[model samples]
Target: MSTPADPGQAEPQFILYLDGEAYEEELRLLATWVHALLLPVYAREVTSAEPWCPRWWEHQEAIARLHGLWLAWQELTDPAAGPSGPALWHRDHLGAVMHELRSPSGPFAGCKQGSHRPKAVPVVEAF
Candidate 1:
């Protein structure tokens, strides 16, 4: 993914599930991407019925899972993956990830449509 760095600056590389100590640069870049690009785009699909957490950044599981999904997206959609890459991404990654993330009992349980924060409710906090 592209970074805020100038074109002359080499972009940082990332791998899924690496040690934070060894991959701080890559981790930061991935976080930036997830927050900046992924969330905004994904938010549009969130309906009141499908709920999503606006404070998803604070949710460790969401971050980790999304990172893994993002990594899979990159690999599965690459040119080298051939003509079926997009189809594979849709079938194998997007469907599963979106279901887990947007399920009624999932990360966004009390959230509403659009860019809303989770509704205040009396429930145990999530990881």
Candidate 2:
């Protein structure tokens, strides 16, 4: 699975999840939001994990990929002119991602409990 390239094939300023006409833009937004929130809450744990830990390695890759997305996110939105556009787009995308996660019957169709990572097609290979 893969995220779509940014318009005109410019190095995708953001991570995108496009599935036919049903583009999963929310994964991209959650990618940004989770990008910001994960470091403080996630990186520390992954970094400190012992090699003996069961899922430490897998978690490590996931963390690193998220960080990469965050870095790109910062690049895409840091400019004075670009921030507003991406930020607003991200907000709407996040809402959409959440709606899908909470939907009655979808990939996230059934589970609507607490915070959950929506299904996404990784843009960068972590495995």
lDDT string for model 1 (1-127, tens) is: 5332345655434454456665566567667877777767654466756777766655555666777777776666767778898789778887788788888877777666545454354588798
Cα-based TM-score, every candidate? 0.61, 0.30
CA lDDT for candidate 1: 0.66
lDDT (Cα atoms) of all candidates against the true structure? 0.66, 0.39
Q: Write the per-residue lDDT of candidate 2 for residues 20-98, one digit (tens) a residue.
A: 4333453445455664574344332211121112221123333344434454444445554354746654564434533
TM-score of 2: 0.30
Q: In terms of lDDT, which candidate is strongest?
A: 1
Which parts of model 2 have CA positions greater than 4 angstroms off?
1-10, 13-76, 80-83, 112-127
Summing lDDT over every window of 10 consecutive residues in candidate 1, give the lowest-scoring window.
3-12
**For every candidate, C-alpha RMSD to the true structure in Å:** 7.1, 13.1
